[model samples]
Target: MTGATTLFTGRITRRSMSGLIIAVLLVTPLEAFAYDNPIVTGTVPLRAGLLLLILLGLRTTRITAVEAGQLFLAQALLSMATWSVLLDFDPNRIAVQTLAYGTILPVCTLLIAPKATRRRWAFLVFCVTLYPAVVRLTPENLGLLAQVIATLLVHGASVAALDTHADRAELAGEMADIDPLTGLLNRRAALNELARGVDRSADDQRSAAIVLLDLDHFKQLNDTLGHEAGDDTLRHVAHVLAAFVRPTDHVCRWGGEEFLVVLPDADEALAIDMAERLRLRLVDVGVTASFGVAEVEAADTVTSWVRRADDAMYVAKHEGRNTVHVARRTDRLTVERPGALGAP
Candidate 1:
């Protein structure tokens, strides 16, 4: 299977595991209650183990923030409803149920929810499960308020700790796919996007273009104006490219002094126009770049398409900077340099 199919299958597996674990946790207590088997204290440990497994499985799967939030909410409601029915309105069991619902459910949800939405989801779970329990406490049972308070404190601290972990994981993922200097997609992410674009173009019978850009005299600027200024110039160029491109386009920092723009559904003429527009925009910022444009072809692979653009870019560099070159798929060896007919 392809990488995408594998990823999709893995995600489905993780989600299935999560659902199974949730079902087991929810049903196990009810089963013990139904059978009146007090020896089944293994519920906690079993649930804890399953929750850990689900968390571990999530490390490789991608779940959206909204989905995570919804999962937490569902877990909270299921736990509350299950405990309420299993305890059969016993006042003595209220404290135990409160502790379990407040602590276990929030911990599980926080572990699964996205870091950015963890706190909100935690608070939501708490209010949904614990607040009602606290409100239902009679005046004669006021002493149980202390247990509720302690559980709240523990849940709060757990959410904070889990949120910290989520933030760190998110930051690591971001750093992996992001170029620090220009804030554009890094090489690995760009290649992934290229593969996706190739698939999309092939499946839809539409053309896509790759524009390879190299800033002219970037090395001289770095030498004379210091690396900081060169960094700023790179960022400015990135901004210009981003501003000029459509939302369907992707911009990536291919490497030092070079950037790649992937334009979906664009033909050779359209790609040349985009490159020229980008070149003119950079000129407004007192910088110039060479652009190599190539359209996708029926038999073209990612490497061949990018190499075509790279070859055209070299032609632009040779002819003179601040120009655009077109490399068509029909002519692999011919580099349509700037000033050539139909060149930008």
Candidate 2:
């Protein structure tokens, strides 16, 4: 779900940027005629065309938010430099241009970095300071001091507001990925992580594994102990699983009483050992779970890999619950050990 939201946000941002580029292209011809400036009449159209091409590249590519923000900032700076050089830094023209971009550029900076850090603040200060210095360097341009100062204040305020907004957006995205009951990642987020792990394992030629577990006779426990007890049991199990996994591992509630753990850079042996330990831990806490371990294969898709693990888990249940089983490469599961709670 978080991935989908990010993709949607990226599409919206790209479309908005494309629209801005098209608007700029349409306005350039008018500017050339209205101003009758040889540079605008001759060179601006070519620059606009180049910008349009860059916008098209943006449409065809996948880039991070920071990268896109940096690209936009680079183009803005290039445009400013072009105006400064071609028009001989005419104070009136440069001042007007600088003020026009003051807000837009700072907002772009927010895209590059939304965190409130000293380095980021320093960069913004440099940008805000540059235009005023240029305007004030020419004695006659001193008359625009009030306008420059106002622009600086406005830019400062906007940065604070924009950074706060970005923080909230990031927090919301994170919250959307979490399970309200277990405080673990939900199924969608888990599947995304598993897909990434599979791709990484395939690309790097490294091993990865997954452990799928389901509470044994959870329906009987809920029926006997009530729904509140079931909720507490789920939360307790989630906490135990989360605490046992390594920092690099991803633990997720795959729904109901089932949990999935993605172990990147781990082989079959390590996965089985981890599963045994986890099962023992649950038993120590007066609960039992069935665990299935499956190592990622060379040609394995996320779906196939998870299905193997799920198949192994059901095999454990069929053999008697609270057992551990390992899925063979050929899609068969062999029971490793009888569960502590077997046949009860």
* lDDT of model number 1: 0.71
Compared with the true structure, all predictions reach lDDT values of 0.71, 0.74
Can you write out model 2's per-residue Cα lDDT over 1-344, one digit (the tens) per residue?
21111211321365566666676668767766755777767777777777666676766545533455456567666766666566664566566666656656665555444344533743563475355446444577665756675776777677777667767987898798899998899998898888987887887677899999999888888889999999999999998998888867888999999999889889999999999999999999999999889999988999999989988887878777788999997766454433533532
RMSD of each: 9.3, 8.3
lDDT of 1 by residue, 1-344 (tens): 01011111111234554664566667666756653634334444454454544555454435533344345456546646655655445555667667767776665556555545656766777767776566667576677867676767876886688668767886788689988888888899899888977886777677888899998888778888999998898888887787778866888999999999988778888889989988888888899888889988877788988888888887778777789989865544454443352322
Considering only N, C-alpha and C atoms within 3 Å, which residue pairs clash in candidate 1? Answer: none
Worst 10 residues of 2 by lDDT: 2-11
lDDT of 1 at 264: 75
What is the total number of backbone clashes in candidate 2?
Answer: 0
Question: Each model's TM-score?
Answer: 0.56, 0.58
**Model 1 spans with C-alpha error above 4 angstroms:** 1-121, 140-156, 172-180, 183-185, 192-210, 217-232, 242-250, 262-276, 294-305, 315-328, 335-344
